[model samples]
Target chain A: MSSWQIIQQSLPLFEKGFVLTLWLSFIGIIGSIIVGLICSLLKYFRVPILSKIAVIYVEVSRNTPLLVQLFFLYYAFPVLGFKLNAELCGIVGLIFLGGSYMAEGFSGGFDGVSKTQVETGKAIGLSQLQLARYVVFPQGLILSVPALAANMIFLIKETSIFTVIAIPEMTNTALDLIGMYYRSNEYLLMLVIGYALILIPLSLILTILEKRVRYGSFGN
Target chain B: MAHSGINVLFEGRNLIRLFGGLWTTVEIAGVALILGLLLGIVLGVLRTFPNRLLRLVLRLYLEFFRITPTVVLLFLFYYILPRQLGVNLPANQMAMLAFALWTSAEMSDIVRGALISVPKHQRESGMAIGLNRWQLYRYVLIPQAVSLELPATVNLVTRVIKTTSVLMLISVMDVINVGQQVVEANNQKFPTGVFWVYGMIFVMYFAIDYPLSWWAKRLDKKRLERANG
Candidate 1:
């Protein structure tokens, strides 16, 4: 079978898969950012034992492969109770994986905010919470935008691993089509092209977003 | 049950066997890393060539490699490539090829950044001294670029080490795969088996990557101090 024919036949399936991929990546990125921000704030506030636990979580999650983490979450989690659907398991796995990486990004961004900014906010008689809310957090967001975008791009590509647990994302769809048709050559080529179609635009969009964020003045 | 499983992992020769698996993982990572550094430097330089076509080709290569997941690439090389080429390769050799390609793309970006960061004045001075392009790169550019590149390169080593675990997916039986196998063989132990085995794998990775990360940080600190002082 010609690659073109295979793609023409598989286009709807690929579209559906692409939608799932985008959904997984978008949700995972947002979820992870929230998780990372919360953990980062906890560490930043020096919340006693919580900070130490956050440190351990970040270290272990960051050090290991996402595949193993996904496997543990998907396959092993059920054994210990707490059943989850494949998609949910994959998203949770991605959340843990992306969250750890983003913690570093958030922490770095938080650290980059000058001490004087906080002191200045204090001099204006803002409460501790108000100081961070009105002054520090915005600057940290701006500082972390580039790192956060890069992490999100990585998370999108890493979502391909969800195929392993049968999530019917782009890669999984390709694997299934291949299995059914046995058109290894055509299917593999379409798979690569399918990924490239999603990934290239995502990367370009991210680069543009990073540039805009860098150039835009956000009322500092 | 947990104690029995732990005994199996730690007993007479099992610890030694696990260490041997760890050694193989290191060997795979170390050899692939060295090869990748060399390939990356070359490709990085090629990408910056005065020739636009060369730059375009390199960009395409970089984009494809960068965007594709390493596991997919591994599957391609291991499963598809041999069938297409009508030649079979051992799984280990295919893993090496896939990783080398992936690392080359990553390292090339680092190399390009490091080289470009060199001051323009140095290049001008080299040209003024009648040094050819090759001589300029050798004497003037590379030495400085190496210093800038060292920290990123060390971080790349950590990436390569962590990525080596993917080889297990293709059945190469690296450290993680062995851990999985040991856990499976002691299935009745449930989560405890996985916990200890994966914990050991985690420690092994930490032992290697932690020092590399430390050295990279130390290098950055020293470089900053030098700039200030």
Candidate 2:
């Protein structure tokens, strides 16, 4: 079959998979941001036992591949009675993996706020929470934008692994088409374009945001 | 679920099988890293040239790999090579090819960064001493660049090792695949065997990779300290 013909036939299937990929990447990145912020704050504040757990969790997630973690969550968690569907497992796994990397980014940013800045905030009659909110967070966030951008891209790319656990994301859809098409390579091209479509624009936006963050446009 | 699948791990030669899988993972990643470093040196050096066209082309190559997921590349080569060129290679070779392609792009960027980071005066000094272009790179620029890029390269190696785990999808029989195999063989007797098998796989990866990451951080710190002084 001609490549264009195959694409025409495959577009519907690809669209279905693309929506799933978008959903997974969306939820995963948002959850990672929330989880990462909480963990980094805990570790930054030296939150006793919770800080230590956060540290270990970061180490474990950073070192292990997400594919294996997904396997653990999907195949094994049923035994523990926390059985999750494939899409849920994909979100949980991405957050589990992306959150630590994001935490590291956030922690780096927090540290980049400089000790002097923290002291200056303290000197202004600001409590720790107020200081964190008023002084440290903005500058730290500027420093972290690049790291957070990388983490976002990394997490998005990782959704490709969802196919392995049978979540039917973009890559999964392509793989299914390839299996049926008998050595045809057309769907593979679509899959790559599908990813570039998302990642390139996202990266461009993040670069703009990184620059905007420098000017204190936190709303972006 | 206390001690859920611990016994499933020690059952017979399962540990040995897991070890064998680890060996395969290491072997492929080792080969890819070495080949990637070599290829990257060539491309990276090319990227540093003053030619606009050359730099543009290299940038496109780098971004192509960067933007596309490596898992996609893995499947691309695995499928295309045999289908298009009739070059019929095995799964392991395809994994290595895909990984080497991806990491070489990463390494080349590191190389370009390291090369440019060498101060302009060093090049002038080499030129004043009547050193040719090749000799300047060989004698002065390379030595400094090597030390400058080492920490980043180590981190890249760590990334390659971790990312290579995706090979299980291509049926490369790496450690994770072996873990699944072990889990399958014993799943009936131990319903939670998948848990322990995969948990152990995670630990095995952490055990090897954490040290490398730590070493990279130390190297990075030392490099920063040297730069500060």
Candidate 3:
């Protein structure tokens, strides 16, 4: 069969997979950022016991792959009475991996704010809220923009690993097609196109965002 | 729903199988890293070619790699590319090729950055000493670039290691592949076998990752000290 013919035959299944990939990546990125924010804040504030827990969490998550974490959650947890759906497992796994990554970035951003600057704000009698509002937040956000962009792209690409657990995302869709119809080349081409459709725009938008954040900044 | 003991991880020949699988993962990543870095250095130097067409082709190669997920690349190489050419390679070799290609793209970019960062004056100095093009790169440019790029390169090593997990998706019998088989064999006896087995592999990955990351940090620290102190 012609490659075009194979792609044409696979369109409907591929569409379902493509949409799921987008949706999963979107939720995973957002959820990871939120989780990262909370965890980094805990460490930034030096919250008593939770900060220690946060450190361990970050280290563990940082050291492991998202694929294994998904396996642990989806396959292992069922034995322990937590039989969550595959999509749920994927999201949690993404957040687990991406959050620690972002926490590290966020904390690094938080740290990138100089200490003497904070002291200078204090000496000037800047209110606590005002100090954080005017000083820490903006700088942290600026410092964080590049890392956040990288993390977002990394998380999005990682959604492809969902094929193992049969999440029916783009990668899984291609795998299924190959299994059923043996059209490896055509369906694989479609899969790559499917991802390029998402990632190219994301990368461009991120570059623009980074430029905006970095523009007019005197010192990096 | 009972949580199985760690003994679930120790049952049968699971540990040996896992260790063997871990060895395969490292071998694949190691082959990719070594070959990729070697070729990447050549490509990096070539990346500065005066030819606009060559530069454009290189740029497209990088952009393609950057956007396409590695899994798709794996699929393309393993299931499609060689088949199209009517050549056959073992599954692991195909995995290695996919990873090496990805690593080369990344390392070439790094090498290009490092090479460019060596500054125009240094190249001028090399020419002032009557060094040929090959001699200049061989003695001065590459050595400096290697040192400058070491830490980032080491971090990339860790990435290559972690990414080998996807070898399982291709059914390459890597660490995760063994872990799955072990888990399946124990599914009847160890209800929580998934947790037990994967948790063990998690540690194994960390065991490999932790030291490399530490080494990278140390290199960064030494580089900083040499610059400042």
Candidate 4:
């Protein structure tokens, strides 16, 4: 088949896979954010044993390869009597991995907050929870938006690995089409474009946010 | 699970084989890092040049590598590139090419950031001291940029080491691949060896990466303190 005909025929499949990639990234990002917040807060508050556990978790996640983590979940989990479908395993693996990276981002954000601000919040009779929610979160969120944006893009790129376990994300869909059509070069180019479509806009937004952060729009 | 699997891993020459795999892993990472550093310096220097067309092309190259998944890149190199080009390269060569591509993009950013962080006044001062453009970069600019980029480059090396795990998927016969093969052969005799096998792989990675990461973080913290001034 001509390259034009191949692209026309493959566009719909690529769209389906592209949407699947976005959805998986959405779930992974949401799940990771919650996990990251909990872990970072644990460390921030120095919550006894949980803080140490959180540290170890972050270290382990950051140090190991995502592929090993995914493989561990996919192959080793069932051996340990926890059987999740490949998609769930991929998402969960991503959450744990992304969460660790995000926790570092969040902890950096928390560290960026001035101690005087915390003291001022306390002086104003704000409870610790109230202080954290109202005073600290806004500052930290502004500081962390760039990190979070970068991590989200990383997570989206990682979603391609789901293809290995048969998740039918963009990469896998393209792999399948390539096999079916025997147009390896064309389809691979298409795959790169498919990813760029999602990532380029995200990166542009990150640059803008980073600029805003540096300009002190949210206040230093 | 099975005690035999644990014993099997420790027994015979299996441990030696795993270590050999580690050697292979390190070799690949070292090669990629060196190649990437060279390529990154070229690309990074080109990025900072006054030529708009050159900058535009470099930006596209950086973005293409940066945004694509490493796994996808591996597939393209391993599966597609050779077939399309009508030339057959070995799997290890392809793996190295893919990794070098990824690392070059990362390293270029590091170089660019480090170069940008150097004050323009330093360049002016170098010129005032009768330094030519080359001397300005060599004597004044690159020295500072290299120091600033050291910690980040170390972190990048650790990352590349971790990423080598993915090479197993392409049958690169790295540590993970060798370990998997051993586990498969012993799986029938020792069905519960999955955790031990994979866990060991994780530990091996951690052993290599954790200390390096810690040192990088320390260096980065120190660099940040200096930069903050």
Clash-forming residue pairs, model 2:
none
lDDT digits (tens) for residues B102-209 of candidate 4: 898888888988898899899788889899878877889889999899998988888889888878868888998888887787777777777777888888999999
TM-score-sorted candidate list, best first: 2, 4, 3, 1
Chain A TM-score per candidate? 0.87, 0.93, 0.94, 0.89
Clash pairs, model 4 backbone: none
lDDT of 3 by residue, A144-201 (tens): 8888998899899999999889999999988988988887878888998999999999
Ranking by DockQ: 3, 2, 4, 1
lDDT of each: 0.80, 0.89, 0.86, 0.85
True contacts kept of each: 0.36, 0.80, 0.84, 0.75
- Lowest-scoring 10 consecutive residues by lDDT in candidate 2 chain A? A211-220
**Winner by lDDT between candidate 4 and candidate 1:** 4
TM-score for chain A, prediction 2:
0.93
Task: Give stretches of model 4 more than 4 Å off.
Answer: A114-136, A212-220, B1-4
Tell me the TM-score of candidate 1's A chain: 0.87
- lDDT at position A77, candidate 1: 59
Interface RMSD list for the candidates: 2.5, 1.1, 1.1, 1.3
- List candidate 2 segments past 4 Å from native: A113-135, A214-220, B1-4
Q: Rank the candidates by lDDT, best first.
A: 2, 3, 4, 1
Model 2 over residues B84-182: C-alpha lDDT tens digits? 989888899888888988889989999999999999999899999999989988999889999899988998998899998899989999999999899
Q: Which residue runs of candidate 3 sit more than 4 Å off their true CA positions? A: A113-132, B1-4, B119-131, B221-229
